[model samples]
Target: MRRIIILLLLLVIALGSAGAVWAHGVKITYTVTFSPTIAIEAAYDTGEPMANAQVIVYAPDDPKTPWLTGECDDDGRFSFSPDPSKPGTWEIQVRQAGHGEWLKIPLDEEMMQSGQGVVTEGGDEGFSTAQIVLMSACVIWGFVGTALFFQSRRPPAQEPGEAA
Candidate 1:
């Protein structure tokens, strides 16, 4: 009887562990390499991407005069490296036929001195370890309790009824 109970407990633990492992769904990782540059994505108030829009960039030293001029791609995304010689705040003016916006891009002194790529990591957004453990323990306890209840309710061994 003791051995049977131990075996049952072991089986429950194994099944519970398997369930916990299966609950951890697929995991994906994304890495992006970034340089000291300004990236802008123009969009309308309705969340529509504004493509082929004129993008005029002005250096920090000379704000009134335009330094660089170009247009955004089809995805309304544009990127440009600031003038390292003039390390400060840059002014970017994005204009279309009817809509226009001004953006300020800042370049620190460290980035100007050492132009090194920076790596940013996006981790897996999933349940914490403690939560997973707690859930697994609850499932195992419930299964064990149910099994014990049914076992206790079984009819005991008895010969043919001779009296009430």
Candidate 2:
């Protein structure tokens, strides 16, 4: 019985840890630096180097300005030279192929000059509604199965006529 209790507690902890990981959103970190030239570094949510991710920079004054563009390398990094003559607030946008959401980052002159940009995917750290419902159902079914399994494994009751 004690072993069963310990096992149950361990199982609960393991499941909770797994759920936490699933609930956490993805993160991307990069830097926007100016050396009279523009430089950037980007990484994917998985932390694995991402190559070919699209990155676009737009000057705040004129969104239509021929924006600078670059693609992340195998190490998930990219750098480009922005028109130094045009210095103003800039918007950085990144998108991975097949990913529906575009990460929009705003950088002021100070930030651009200092070179810092950090963006995280999925703002919230929690399961979606559908996922929550499915997980609840799974837990309930697991408990019901455990109970039935124990019941089935129990020894049969002894008859009154049987010797002690």
Best by lDDT: 1
Quote each prediction's TM-score: 0.49, 0.46
Clashing pairs in 1: none
Instruction: Using TM-score, give the best candidate's number.
Output: 1
Estimate, for each residue in 44-155, the C-alpha lDDT of model 2 and write its tens digit.
4334445677777786677765377767777656666655555665556655764412334454555445444443122212355468657876986788588768856865
RMSD of each: 15.0, 10.2
Determine which window of 10 residues in candidate 1 has minimal summed lDDT.
Answer: 23-32
Encode model 1's per-residue lDDT on 43-148: one tens digit a residue: 6543455688888999989999999999988867777766678878777777788576776655656666576655433423345657766786798778778877
Can you tell me which runs of candidate 2 are displaced by over 4 Å?
1-26, 64-66, 100-164
